[model samples]
Target: MDLSTVTATLASKSYDKVADICDNLMLQVATDGIGYHDDWPYAIHLLSHFYVNDINSARFLWKSIPSSIKENKPEVTAVWRIGQKLWLRDYAGVHEAIRGFDWSQELQGFVAAFSELYTKEMFQLLLSAYSTISIADAALFLGMNEDDATSYVQQQGWTVDSASRMLTVKKQPVVTEQKLDPSKLQRLTEYVFHLEH
Candidate 1:
């Protein structure tokens, strides 16, 4: 399969077709001793995995590539770094990393795919810090409207006080057992034995 065809398929989000073409290309390169540069295929494969939220496969692909390739291709390296930040739940780091760089179409698509995940991570970060937060505040933090923020909170099983416009994270209740008196325990044991007879 032509590399341009593979690139076009990936741009069109035909992920399964891209995977098949990439796999065939890899097989050809391996068995026929064909001199094929692996960069483009790897990039497409990485994006395919990212588009599907398959971070483990993406990580494997990123790591399996030659370090020389990583060093030589700045775009690939940048994409890999962003993927790493995403995997690490460093949503802020991903935002910071992509800020000033002019990304190619493929990279732009990859970033767009990750935006929802980034927002989810941001919500988790905020929840970890505060047990209760205002829906307005959550909307602002998540870059969503108030209704959407409220919907998200409700979907997650968090309580929302519409009057206060606040979300309440229900705390798990702690249970404690009362200590038994030794004297009462002996009497209870004797009573149980008598009843058994």
Candidate 2:
């Protein structure tokens, strides 16, 4: 599929067709050294849209998610399951999957700042589920020693104990009363979760 067609399909929420087109686009970009900017590889990672509504289909499509993105972001994994729910038009399943997720604060912040900069709603959709990993998992994901991850999280104002407990978890439901600057927001969401790409 052509890039224009693929973009148009994604614009219309033709997610399955967009996925197929993206798969081909990635291969073409990889093999031919052509099309898109340097971030093309990262762009391809966005296509995985597995839906729990179609258990069999979800299982099949889940395999398409690239390892790099999957290892770093559990929300992406969850969102694919949401996509499966979207596929089957199972409103209840989608609700169940996204229950307890709160997008209000992040969405408000993003809309106040970045909504105009981005055309796609994917990041806005993802605002709720983004969270910092456990220190051990963060260490593993970052290929760092436990000490490093501890220091990093500490630097970000999180407290961790050697007993493997996150003593000061911040990704909980409460939004801070103070509004964050864009840099602080970037650190809190992007760096905290190692989703810097």
Top model by TM-score, which number? Answer: 1
In model 2, residue pairs whose N, Cα or C atoms come closer than 3 Å (at least 3 residues apart or on different chains), thus clashing, are 50-80, 50-84, 51-84, 51-85
* Model 2 C-alpha lDDT per residue in residues 1-197, reported as the tens digit of each score: 24676646645544445456655776786698674442332322332223102345445546655676667655555555545655675544544545423434322232222212221222222223344445655554333456875675566555666565543544436666986689888778967678646
Taking the tens digit of each residue's C-alpha lDDT, what string does model 1 give over 93-131? Answer: 666555546777765765565556567867777777779
Give candidate 1 regions above 4 Å deviation: 15-21, 98-100, 116-197
lDDT of 1 at 53: 63
| Overall lDDT per candidate, in order of appearance | 0.71, 0.47
Against the true structure, what is each candidate's TM-score? 0.54, 0.31
